[model samples]
Target: ALPDAIEEVSQADQDAFNQDGLGYLADKARTLDALPSDAWEPDLAAFDALIASLAIEGMPETGLMQGSWLWVGQRALGSDAPTPVLDPPAYEIAFGEGDVQVRADCKRADGTYAADGGMTGALSLTLNPTTMQICSEDSQADAFLTALSQVDRFAIAPGAHTMQLFLPDGSVMSFAQAE
Candidate 1:
């Protein structure tokens, strides 16, 4: 009994069992009082091929899990919005064994500063051990700065985390921590 429980079965054996048509084989064996003394190789090979061709699909993740921050924003600036456009918003992530520090800089192709060819105001985040602060250096860029201020603090763990930012006008940005 122990040997039967622990014994291994091979793919070939499995193929042979399936190919033999379990129901039919059982009936024939019962009627004949035993299996045919002749070879049953052809039926076994066909079953092996069928099992070999089968593929299994991957399953998606499921569980109750939460991240530090979650940012959600639109892909386009607005409907029929002109180019040299800026993204809605995006999240930034990093990892450290103890505590991690991360920074993000977001700027549009359009000029927000007086500097030539410089994108509008910069949106940056400085993440310390347990705290993350998002800020904008240029006061003239109130839209981005105000957006940064709305986010409070988040609790980060050793696993994955996310950050989300939203503007007063309802624009949003989000990022996630790496696994």
Candidate 2:
């Protein structure tokens, strides 16, 4: 005859059964059931390509304007009609050894600029546009392009990460390095 009460199962045996048997099976079942037949799936190839492109886009180039910069605001001399650029357009400037390039959301200006006089407080820049493309009707772009043409002096903040370009009208254009 069978015993009325069976011996108590050892704690080690119970733990092993829970981890290696039931737990393993439960995990496997969950993994298989996690995705439904109608569930949407991402295209890994495209995802990987997008990630690669973003990485490349974030990389800083080699030169003075090697890193990416964004427009913060502008301070004019007398009036502030262009009030603090609350939602400033997506504008950027990249400087190289002897070139300055600008990219606004709807426009682009690429030309040669000289910064040699910057050291002696004779800072000056000239944007002789070789190419100008207008993609959209952007007033901020217009303002920036106009300001770029008028900028004659520039100052790099003590940190060297922030920059200010002074226009002939005493207006100042501010920029900060991108993360």
TM-score of 2: 0.53
Model-by-model lDDT, in order? 0.33, 0.61
lDDT of 2 at 60: 38
Q: Taking the tens digit of each residue's C-alpha lDDT, what string does model 1 give over 24-61? A: 33344455434343335456457546755766554211
**C-alpha displacement of 5 in model 1, angstroms?**
56
Q: Estimate each model's TM-score.
A: 0.21, 0.53
Q: List the residue pairs that clash in candidate 2.
A: none
Kindly provide the TM-score of model 1 when superposed on the true structure, using C-alpha atoms.
Answer: 0.21
Candidate 1 weakest ten by summed lDDT:
111-120
Candidate 2 per-residue lDDT, tens place, 1-179, comes to 22354356557655655655534433444565465534425554565466556545544333245465677788766544435654444788877766777776667777776663322222445666524656465347778778878876666666567777777556778877766
RMSD of each: 24.5, 24.2
Give residue 27's error in model 2 in angstroms.
76
